[model samples]
Target: MIIFLRRKMSRSKECLMKYNSKKALLVTGERKLKNTSEKLFSELKVSPFYLNQLSEVLPFLSRENVDIIIFGSDTYQTQKETFSELLQTVSLNYPQSESIILARENDVPFVVSVLKFGSTHYIKYPVGIKELQSLMKSAMATQPAISPRLEKEPGKDSSRFGLIMGKSTKMQQVYAQMRHAAMTDIPVLLIGETGTGKDLAAQTIHQQSERSAQEYLPVNLGSLPNELVASELFGHEKGSFTGATHQHIGVFERATEGTVFLDEIDSVDEKVQISLLRLLEQKKFNRLGGKKTIKTDARIIAASNENLEELLRKGQFRQDLYYRLDVFRITMPPLREKIEDIPMLIEDFLTRFNKLFNKKVKKLDPECLEVLQAYNWPGNVRELKNIIQRAVLLAEGDRLYIHNLPPRLQKTRRSAHSISFRIGTPLDQIEKEVIKETLALTHNNRTQAAKLLGITRRALYNKLNKHKLK
Candidate 1:
């Protein structure tokens, strides 16, 4: 009897708890897909409630014991906001249950965004039983996996961005978004602070995209003259204007069947925005003094440091154009938001400069790397890249040291490396001093420093105000 019971006990440990098929809720209306979804849930032995719209699921969610709620992102075309709102609602109402989005393999951006929004998992289509079983098991766990952000999936490669190297979760999400943008002809709007590698990301999209065989042109809308913006974008016929000595093809035209990167797109004037909007809608434009319509097949990948949505509300941007481009937007995180990626980025830049400047200097000092991590890079990746390159080219030593860094960075090392305290020091005083040191190390970046100090930003702010450091 004891031996027979041991065998049964071992079998139970290997198998997942069987869930009723009716306990599942799927938000899909497509009959074919719904059939497939139903079959998968049946195989997993989980009952599901099928709802067409996201709205139907909300009311049902309050009463039903939904183990897993699955939806297709195709339901939301340009209404990403509504989709997000639905996810938020589900998260609030049913925080314990798992939300799975049934997505296409090419919907990499969509997957990344939703995963960041606290989705537990996703079912990629032509869905298979094995994958579904795995997802089911994860969902049915006593403690469900929540938030797919900075996913450090085992055996997953997060170093595909080449010189923009990263194993960090933030970079992995960026890579996924970039990969998805590259596969489609969709116009991508990159939102991030300056020096966040928006230009690099634009270039990556163009390079990895289907149009890579053609020309890749970059235009800085912020630098273009108001009077000449039209000519620069759409070209001009010979003698069309004072400087139009010969027929010229503009950046948009030059990038036929390719990509045109409009950097600092927020800086575009209302006049240019109108032209851009028309071109995006019609894919056709006329050169100055030319009546003939010239159609372009160029793909657009616009980048900006400012919030385009905010500008749209201010009536500085067109709403229709914003929706078309914004649905597939990719926002790059600031340096402070993903400080874990700094070390790999530093190594990459260091190696590249070593080869470029014909130097053999290697092994960045540990202390030097710590200071680099602590200091908030206002200029983002570009600033760090430039700093590393300079240090690598100028260093006489075989390995990089603190002295190799810039004066501002070097000064930070002193305040960051040590914190003095008395044996009789009060707890509040010690806390204040540590906060000050951390802030100094992070160069007044409250967010990163607060994280380093293991306290909330509000807590750090209150301490700063108390110590009169603000």
Candidate 2:
């Protein structure tokens, strides 16, 4: 029996070497806890690669075979220092490794801050051995075994990631156009109203394209001064201008091998536009006050709230440049056209703010949502996000009622309420009136009204007939 037990233990050790040799690296200052962790892993039939400190483990990390890294509090604790430098080092070095941190309950706020810096999971220390094993198993099961910064699915319809959210047919059409634009390397022109997320659309294209691994640089052409526009885009050598203190790399140079998003491209002067056209055609440009021509390989993506074709016709923009950028165009639908997305947008904003402010804002009142749907969102998604953020910040309870909304939205709600009532209205007549109001509110769409009323189209028609109203 003793010989058999010894053979079984040897076989178990051999299996561990074959299957669990890709050991987890644990960094901790406490020797006693390190031993405890090792013992726990032994009971779980796993092996750990322990290091006394992060600096000591850095050498091992330089090797590609190290599977996972676990950072303990001793390595991350610093009073006067931010973790930015540490995160940059990790990102520049590993870029793909999964990093887990053992934190304290009180470190939740600090953990959240470091999350943006690249650290993955943060679990409270003194964790049960079972829980630790479960976490390890789950982490290993994940493809790539690393957390991704962007949540968007690769190769999905680009419009679905376009920062505009809706499931309506109109939105689907817009999404289709966005996907087609993303498939090519052509310069895309996005035309839409102010706050309509033209910039968002450009970013979605950048994220979805083959150039996704490269940098995505956004420049607001309308905000740059006319005199400085050329230098800003094409870089400047020393003494290029009186204020050009030293040699500078421009947006084009920084965005080489990547994408450069030009917002309000039509606002650029004709001379600037001509230089831009030359760069697009030749893929090369000279520095300001310099004779040497530098080559760039950046993809161009332009957007404008105003109509560039109209600008070209009115002699305000260069027609050649406009045509070059308009090879693939996407026009985003206004919020008023897809008001059905307002409720979803509102919920998304509220959930985001709830996490941001650590509040418990649960729901937006139905009346508040109705009011939001009725308003013509001239400022579009940007305005809606701002309003919801402000409301969430001011809300004192779980529910966001109409009174907590902006004054404009509140006034719209009052107007809607005033129009919804009538004197001496019968029960059946009131039902019909309510149905008609809902239908009109939904742009006279029967399908949408029926969904809103929680009834089928046939049932809604029956109600209309029973009320003896057309």
lDDT per residue for candidate 2 within 373-430, as digits (tens), equals 7666779889999998998999999988888888877776545453455677777777
lDDT of 1 by residue, 1-470 (tens): 00000000111211223322236787776888787777787777777677888767766765665667777656655567788777765553344456777667676466557665543566677667677667766555532322222122334454756335666667767776665566467789999999888888888877765577799899888897877878889888999989789998888888878899989888777777778888998999888788899899999998889988789889988787777677568888888888878877877777788889998887888888888888777898888988998898789978999888999888767744787787999998888788877776777888888778777779878888888887
Model 2 vs. true fold: TM: 0.58
What's the TM-score of every candidate structure? 0.64, 0.58
Candidate 2, run of 10 with poorest lDDT: 1-10
Off by over 4 Å in 1: 1-156, 309-320, 424-429, 454-470
- Each model's lDDT comes to 0.73, 0.70
- Model 1 lDDT on a 0 to 1 scale: 0.73
Q: Global CA lDDT of candidate 2, please? A: 0.70
Clashing pairs in 1: 20-47, 21-46, 21-47, 22-47, 23-47, 24-47, 24-48, 150-169
Candidate 1 global TM-score = 0.64
